[model samples]
Target: MKIRTIVFLTLFTCGSLALLVGSWLQVIPFTLTEDLGFITGALSVWLTVVENIWNFPIGIANDIFFFVLFWQAGLFADMGLQVLYVLLGLQGWYLWLHGGKNKTSLRVSNISPLELLVLVLITGIATTSLTFYLQTLQDSAPFWDALTTVLSLVAQYMLNKKFVENWYGWILADLIYIPLYIYERLYLTGVVYVTFLVMCLFGIRAWLQSRRAYA
Candidate 1:
């Protein structure tokens, strides 16, 4: 295998093993709030690792897991986001396999200026709509949650298209999520978002490498 691939696998495997053992042994508390389940919490962190590596299949799995996780956490918007992630993930898998040159597998591609503009517009509209709806329902951190939710939706869509800008969106959302989950008292989940935020930096670098390879 290539050096980068080997390094990624080694780090991913080691980190996952350490985290899993820590959780099983109750080393890191394994939990921060009853707001989230152990498995759900575990998968959330796992999602960050796989996504950073641009692994779409595992992304699909974690997206499904989060669908259940967010639902149980009473995060209806996030639960809905998982549904969209799963749907788009399926499309992403197909595209990655068939959306490439001459109907071969798709390669990493850049977003056009038009798509970037659309992403911004979509973020604005979704955030506004969710903010109003959530406020009416008196949900906790409605604006923050709405903003992160919209950003996450945009990020997931960008990931589906293999757009490098997705990493930036993810970083923004993950930062917001840390405090949002903390407010919900899901401290472990909050920490997981912290990990996600850091991995997003690595993800940006990895995607940039991919872009360079294609360019």
Candidate 2:
């Protein structure tokens, strides 16, 4: 890592820790777990935008925190999604290290049109089924929750495969998530999603540059 990158990560981590402490002390209106999740989630996304492999471990931590937080909030689909994220995070870690041609480091690539069509169909069907299941459980925001959950899974898969289109999926998911989290009264988490939305734009630009470099 470069010196500037180390300095930035250190500063960001410290600032996040301060927010977590403030939440714990009741100085902030957010829960401790939500704050922790926000910190790890934000860092993970930022690192991902920079194409860093370290995002996987940090994202796994975010997934654990969010699982507990979502469970308490009665977002069953999201809680389940976190579990899948941990598994995906592990796979993404390895792929980022050696999933390219000849087992080299992964490079950003575009998703094929057929793959895009298949993913869209899968997302639609999965969201419908999950929404129905959540409705049976009286889940709040069932349709939106199910939609974001499936979108997130698709985005994570694209990310693991180093597809540049992953940012589009994340951007769509985050747009829905910002309002959904606020409705659930997880204001801090909503804010985190807003941040994720912005970082995803940067991810798109950075990954495109990377792809051009590879070419």
For every candidate structure, what is the RMSD over all alpha carbons to the true structure, in angstroms? Answer: 3.8, 1.4
C-alpha lDDT of residue 123 in model 1:
86
Model 2: how large is the Cα RMSD against the reference? 1.4
Using TM-score as the measure, which candidate wins?
Answer: 2
Highest lDDT: give the candidate number.
2
Task: Give the TM-scores of the predictions, in the order they appear.
Answer: 0.79, 0.95
Give me the displacement of residue 145 in model 1, in angstroms: 1.6
Model 2: lDDT equals 0.94
> What would the TM-score be for candidate 1 when compared with the true structure?
0.79
Please provide, for model 2 over 124-213, each residue's C-alpha lDDT reduced to its tens digit, 9 standing for 90 to 100: 999999999999999988999999999999999999999999999999999999989998999999999998998899899999999999
Which ranges in model 2 have alpha carbons more than 4 Å from their true place?
1-7
Tens digit of lDDT per residue, candidate 1, span 47-118?
433433345556666666667656667777777777777787778777766777897765566789998998
